[model samples]
Target: MWLLIAVSVFVGFLIVLYLASPLITPKPLDLKGVHVLVTGGSSGIGKAIAVEVAQRGANICLLARNKAKLEEAQSEIEKVLVDKNQQKVIHISVDISKDYAAVVQAIQQAEEELGPVVLLVNCAGASVAGSFEDLSLNDFKRMIDINYIGTVHVTRAVIPSMKKNQHGRIVFISSQAGQIGLYGYTAYSGSKFALRGLAEALHMELKPYNVYVTLAFPPDTDTPGFAEEQKSKPEETRLISETAGLFQPSVVASSIIKDVVSGRFFSYAGLDGYMLAAVTCGMSPVTSIMEATQQVACMGIFRIISLFYLDHFDRICRKCKQERSDPSSEKKTS
Candidate 1:
């Protein structure tokens, strides 16, 4: 009798939770005719996202430091527009990490041409992988400048309009490195992790005004930036990342756009990403009861799985260290 009663109560609670989910969920943002500004949109995942939004009928403003590349991306994105006559795409050349005034000016130009940006995608970022001591001070500074502060500059510039309009979506394209620290990512990981704090705080401040924030944790992707990153990656870092596999830019961009439009607080690309997000989703805003329940139910299991992953990673580190100390072992294996 007690077992049956317990099952009944659990089922009843789930039903209630499902019914209340609609009340907590934000209405999906429509992309048609909306203005979206994507930093680093001249190439890689940023360009992919611009194409995705353009296909949804949003006017796009691509921001990057290379004018030539920006123009190239603009031409490519223009080809994918749903409305060839009405939908427009523009590009701006500016270093988002260096000059706040330049970022502001660039934003003004975009808004003047396209209209107030209703969606801001903070995708501009840089990565440098090395041991803590091996990385130059400039490397650390550059990662922080481009990945964290650049995001800050662009997000800050767009806040006023988003608040005034009382409706907007902001996306921060943080990597899987942001969710968990790994070998040879001291500089890169620190910068990406900083974005989470900013996103969380901004989510609270903007929620009252109907503006939403989505922090995306994308796994290793096949992009020009990723190829560059591979050159600097330590052997252990490369091996560790390979376990999650590589994703295409289009797949990552699609997941990010879907989450942003749905007003999800945390966006992730794959099963591994979903597990990482759930494990790290402490005290973050809950978009729906279902999401909250999944986090609650899955957190413990995911944490256990993470421990196994950590052990495997530790083994890799130990093996690498052993090989370094005894060069003969590396040669013998080869």
Candidate 2:
């Protein structure tokens, strides 16, 4: 029994390594001389991806709502430059709510000015945290409008030009909650879940045409948007967020850029997020079930395991505080 268990563990790890290897990498999304567009480039993960791609010598077209913020982001992108010969970036301010056709026009204009947009990042999104009962129809619609429909709008406009050029990369910055739904994330997760389905279907349709699509599952990114959501979240959601340390947008951006350049369909940004995705990818889920009892270590069980590690750091901090305050503990150290 022990030998069988060891064999299974070794096999599982090998399979993971095989799938994660970049040898399967396709054409690079390195935008050298190519143009790229990222919605929500005013700040956060979208902005980070913009910077990273710009550094690679791509001419950029920034998209967002605030004119001042877009200009500011363009300035920041310019500050990183070593010379004028390297490709530069441009800004176009538009609300992605698809509330205005002007947003679509702006994207087209960008493609015309910068050259066919070879990369698109649909990172503009929002989350409304509340009990299912507390959320209204309008709340749900708003989440859908900005998160899902907005994605459709952008992809619809961007792909036609990409098809004409026979090349492009489209990325959707989904969340872990989209994969494993949460108690208070019904609305947010719904939009992200739908986004994943769209990305999958789009990938199959476009692979023949050389256009690549990637859906990134990032867990609880440390963005200003998330900070704002935390201020009014339910206690249960807040506890969950605290356990899942807010991930940096740069981490998300870097991982996504690698996958995009490599023509991979999926990328996971958070440690726990990637682990969960790994388990999902390997549906047989080996070495998890007790061999003798045959008790299945299901998805729910795996999630609880993630929660345990997610809260470990916080628990250690609390333990250290208690130990420092206890006089007996101090004497033991001394």
Q: How far does residue 330 in candidate 1 sit from its true spot (Å)?
A: 2.9
lDDT of model 2 at position 184:
76
Name the top lDDT candidate.
1
Highest TM-score scorer: 1
**TM-score of candidate 2 on Cα atoms, chains taken together:** 0.78
Candidate 2: where are CA atoms >4 Å away? 1-25, 282-334
lDDT of 2 by residue, 1-334 (tens): 9999988986785566456422233566667878889998888888889988877777888888889989999999877654558677898877788665887788878977887888999988888888788888888999999999888888888998888888999999888877766667888889988987898778768766778788888777778888888876765667666666777888888888987887766677665665666545422211221211122235566667767755764565455556757858746867
Scored against the true structure, residue 249 in model 1 reaches a CA lDDT of 96
Model 2 lDDT-worst window of ten: 284-293
Tell me the deviation in Å of residue 131 in model 2: 0.8
Residue 80, model 1, lDDT: 92
Prediction 2 global C-alpha lDDT: 0.76
| Each prediction's whole-model lDDT (CA) | 0.92, 0.76
